[model samples]
Target: MNFTTQRIEDIVVFTLNETKLDANNSGLVKAEFTLLMKLESVKKLIIDLTDVESCDSTGLSALLVANRLVHANDGDVCLVTSSEKVLSLIRITQLNKVLSVFDTLTDALQELKSK
Candidate 1:
């Protein structure tokens, strides 16, 4: 998966460039995100999935695990989901209630800053 990371002041913004986030690419996502979360000063995270095509259970699990880690550090993960398929998966898994999802990356960043 292709990705880029930037800090929105204290919050980090991770934008996915890939069209898919499945088992084949979920591991990379987890590793990259885990590394970012290790920063002591980092707090909130905004995951931009505007270009994401689909997400599988493994991808969802990776995101959930990352969210948990962020929460443990008094931070949170806000997802910018533009993919219907991904949103459907989250809905089916009842993860939408557990994770904060936004329609745009800007909205996600705003929510993160508010927190």
Candidate 2:
């Protein structure tokens, strides 16, 4: 699997298992995540990119789709990653202002909980 998901209470966390989130698998990522958003019980989502070494535009698009879905459902979404490359791409694309990003899984979860 490209990612593993664990749901605790109302928050769902997706831990990417792939090293690169590029065109090849971004569609799969988007499709699966979209389905998660439809789960009415899910109130928040945390995407953990700890294993993702890099990402492309398509990967970023997938993230955006998740964000939109969450918001449409009146929920929140957060990202957890330590990759400088991924973080840089997010900044360059000006998505940093749109998405909440954290350095650790704990931080993301805590922020989501507090919100």
Candidate 3:
């Protein structure tokens, strides 16, 4: 799992640097999300998947795990991706209704900050 994490105020921006987010690395991503959600100050998270061109069911499941953990902590989690495949999957799975999706990190940050 190639990724980078940065804190912008109270929000944690986690950028997945991999081209594919699949079963091979989704579990690591999920674990990272779980750990981040446990922190007292991390109330908002922006998962930047701009570099991720492809995603599998496990990848989507990892995202769901992040959403669940964040909401359980009374926090928010959003995803940023420019990949059409990823966007299509979110729509097909109806995850667009459950998770906030954005085209850019700036857009995601603004929305999360407003909340």
Candidate 4:
């Protein structure tokens, strides 16, 4: 898996260490998220996409699904380091307003904590 997850306080921090977030890596990302959500008190999530190079609708859908899942659990999702291309796609798709995006991990974490 090109993704990894660790806990920091009450948040589940998902770090993407891959160049692509296309279909090939979406499953891995989804599975790791499933595993992380199983843990208790994980009411906040930070997705670090600093290394992600590309994303399709499928990958973006996965993120929305994750966000929905988190919200269902009374939690929220924060996006970190969204590349310019990804950010553009997000804006065009109106997903930028849907997801909580941050330019840095610290900002993401602080946003999560504030919620």
TM-score of each: 0.93, 0.94, 0.95, 0.91
Better of 1 and 4 by lDDT: 1
Q: What's the candidate order when arranged by decreasing TM-score? A: 3, 2, 1, 4
lDDT of each: 0.85, 0.89, 0.92, 0.82
Report how far residue 82 has shifted in candidate 2, in Å: 0.5
lDDT of 4 by residue, 30-100 (tens): 77677667765567888899888788887887788788878889888998865898888888998878888
Residue lDDT tens for model 1, 1-115: 5799888688888888988888898998888877777765456888888999798998898888778878888878898987889999999999989889999988887888887
Candidate 4 ranges with C-alpha deviation above 4 Å: none
Candidate with maximal TM-score: 3
In model 2, the worst 10-residue window by lDDT is 34-43
TM-score of 2: 0.94
Which lDDT value does model 1 have at 84?
88
Error of 2 at 49 (Å): 0.5
Better of 2 and 4 by TM-score: 2
User: What lDDT does candidate 2 reach at residue 26?
Assistant: 91
- lDDT of candidate 3 over 1-115, digit per residue (tens): 7899999988999999999999999999999988777655567989999999999999999999988888877889999999999999999999999989999999999999899
lDDT of 3: 0.92
Ten consecutive residues with minimal summed lDDT in candidate 3? 34-43
